[model samples]
Target: MLPSASRMRRGEEFADAIRRGRRAGRPMLVAHLKTREADVPPLVGFVVSKAVGGAVVRNRVRRRLRHLMRTRLTAIPRGSLLVVRANPPAASARSEHLATELDVVLDRLLRGRRSESRTLTDGRS
Candidate 1:
């Protein structure tokens, strides 16, 4: 289970991340990440729809994702929000596979963000 402080519980928060944040996708999951200017602990949310599976499968997948995410929490920037949506493929994927995908997508997303911020600062300095 994620620590309550690190979880995103509101619908609007999820919507903001999914609709306005930077996104990265893999065969098993899609990650939407939104950054804020303040330095606070990052918050994370997960979505596993019916298309992914029934209650049992969805819960299982959610638990696996939650645990996997715990390992990567430090990688997230302060005050940022992240939503991880599991696709149907996630229902059958092993935890290791899911972790691999998560790492890849997050690396791509965060690496791009770093370069973007650099460009912005470089232009002004």
Candidate 2:
């Protein structure tokens, strides 16, 4: 279970992250990450729509995602907002597979952020 403080609960929070964040897409899920300058803990949210499945399947996927994010909280940057939107395939994905996909997507996003910051510091586009 994810800690309540780390959860993104409001509609605007989710919208801001999804609209302004960098995105990494996979067969199982799409992750959006928006980093902030504040020193607060990272916030995470999940979107499991009906396109993924019925209530039970959506809830199951959401639970799996929450558990995966709990273990990965430290890896995310401070003051970042992350939204994981489930693709239909996630409904049937194994926990291990979801973990792997999440890791891959997160690595891409984090790496992108790192390179971008490096470029800015180096005075290059």
Candidate 3:
């Protein structure tokens, strides 16, 4: 399990990730913030709410999320906070399902963002 400090988004950060971040879907939201002058960026936190379930169930979801992130981190952009919200349907979601969903959304979001940045960098408006 990821440490709480490393696994949970606080109130303001969570709100920012929701409101300003580029959302991948209903199940996940992601926002990237550059580190304060560092080459290596750390994955900060992931939040799964009680609306997801009781303690045991919520923690299970979080663990699944962390594992997915670990496996797929290379595809994830640097300095990003990924907030994966659990739908009620996900309470019983299998590990493979959870991993696939996270991978799909993160890959799509990252690809779109990188392509847009490339276009802008190439002087396209």
Candidate achieving the largest TM-score: 2
Q: What's the distance in Å from true for residue 72, model 2?
A: 0.7
Report clash pairs, candidate 2: none
lDDT of 1 at 34: 92
38-117 per-residue lDDT for model 3 (tens digits) = 34444545666787789998888777777766656655455555566667666787888777777777766677778878
Q: For every model shown, what is its TM-score relative to the native structure? A: 0.96, 0.98, 0.75
Comparing 1 and 2 by lDDT, which wins?
A: 2
- Tens digit of per-residue lDDT, candidate 1, span 47-103: 999999999999999999999888899999989989999999999998789899999
Off by over 4 Å in 2: none
Worst 10 residues of 3 by lDDT: 29-38
Output the better candidate (1/3) by TM-score: 1
For model 2, how does the per-residue alpha-carbon lDDT over 20-72 read when each residue is reduced to its tens digit? Answer: 99999999999999999889999999999999999999999999999999999
Please give the lDDT score at residue 16 for candidate 3: 58
lDDT of 1: 0.93
